[model samples]
Target: MHRTLLWLLATAALAGSAGPPARTAMPAPPPAVGEAARTGGRPWPVPGTPVVVRTWNPPATPYGPGHRGVDLAAPPGTEIRAVAAGRVTFAGPVAGTGVLTITLDGSGSPPLRTTYEPVRALVRVGERVAAGQLVATVETEEAAPAHCKEEGCLHWGLKRGEVYLNPLALVRGGHARLLPVWGV
Candidate 1:
């Protein structure tokens, strides 16, 4: 019965076509480069924040699937920052994702890597940036703008070479323990 119900839901979603039932409308996007973005931002998303965290690695099915990234919920225009120092490997609108992917040369667990564009990439594939630097902004689409299995939340995946690492481990490693940000 459960399997049948799941199949039915999947069928309905596909039938909608206008793109996954049109997720709740997020507020119109704020200017892409807000103060933080302009200044390589910091703790941007906070509690009460509306979006949902997508993936934290693997980017597949977390359990029986491969989890490739970490996800955070937010509206478009939310300032995104580089966790550590690195070079921008690729940035631009790939497919439909307004996305940005930064490959930290040396920092934050095997090159502090960060991606901000699942909807539209901002930086190029090889732009050098500093830690806390603003790489790009979020998209303000009613549904997941791009690069997502489902357009609902920000999917973040941390990786080193071919290994998909858990994002929380990095933040909670060694001595520091930054609590997960719920929403603002």
Candidate 2:
């Protein structure tokens, strides 16, 4: 009983050092449907089918512990497309997860880049792909057991320089709705 009490105290001390988790009241509304096209943006990286996002939390700082991108709910082997016309800059594994990066043309002063991860890349580095073109496929348990078997989702990310942007902002057509998480 004494040892257990000590362990609980130590755990509480470590938890206190970690501080409270960051929370946002809620994000502002997203653009209406077709608003992106009206604004001259390209279609979603994965189109046609409705995208179900499992997670959409970006880190407040570089290398922070928060989720750096949105995880889209997709089955294994689903085709992953390019969100915009760009050249494939990377198509390889990074720290175990398969990552694909595309540098957008005429996107901004510093240029925008998009990244998809835990995918079985089909395109080669330096390959110029058009908007909505297939670049990779979601990984299956046979391909990436760690991520695919755990949860079949595509982690879609966007960045300009070192600043991460919300990838969903590029595709969300309606207002943002916060999904509640209930615990037992």
Candidate 3:
């Protein structure tokens, strides 16, 4: 009886010590090449500028093991523009990193919410901004860790209700579909 009791206590102690699961948010799968066309929207958040996708994993659930957004290879202090007309809803720090959210207007039921992270907000909350209008600037390593090696990156995300939608769909005019290079 004593041995069984000890085993139970050891198991309980180990389980309690385990704590919460570590967050392993993987990058979302590549978006469809060209799904449905965007109803209507502006250009890339950073226009006329070349950008590389650093990370593109969107979490599979509202709180799941997936990247909830895409990280673009952007230099620190790069200007971030609004993808569409909307009013700034949130501009604040999240876990020591700055985050800015804009609730898009006329985006349909629930309204799509766009988020830019590791940014320094240039626009104020509740301020109306037009497509292509500057809203924030990517922060430098001095402010936060350079997420993209020494270059830094901008984490952009889009969500409707609690569902995380690919923000690339907005930039590419639709979903970025995967096309086979050679037919088998």
The number of clashing residue pairs in model 1 is: 48
* Residues 62-159 of candidate 2: C-alpha lDDT, one tens digit per residue: 87776556666567787887877899999998887788999987665566789997788999999999776789998775444343455576778877
**Candidate 1 wrongly placed segments (more than 4 Å):** 1-64, 107-112, 142-152, 175-184
Better of 2 and 3 by lDDT: 3
Residues 34-143 of candidate 3: C-alpha lDDT, one tens digit per residue: 11113343456653443545434554465767666667667788888887789999999988889999999877667789999889999989999887788999987655
Return the top candidate by lDDT: 3
Error of 1 at 89 (Å): 0.5
TM-score, ranked from best to worst: 3, 2, 1
lDDT on C-alpha atoms for all candidate structures: 0.48, 0.64, 0.66
In candidate 3, stretches whose alpha carbon ends up further than 4 angstroms from where it belongs are 1-41, 142-147, 174-184
- Cα TM-score of candidate 2: 0.65
Per-model TM-score, in order, reads 0.54, 0.65, 0.68
Instruction: Tell how far residue 110 is off in model 3, in angstroms.
Output: 0.5
Tens-digit per-residue lDDT, 84-158, candidate 1:
567878776656666667785644334445565454444567777765555666666543534443434555555
In terms of TM-score, how similar is model 1 to the real structure?
Answer: 0.54
Better candidate number, 1 or 2, judged by TM-score: 2
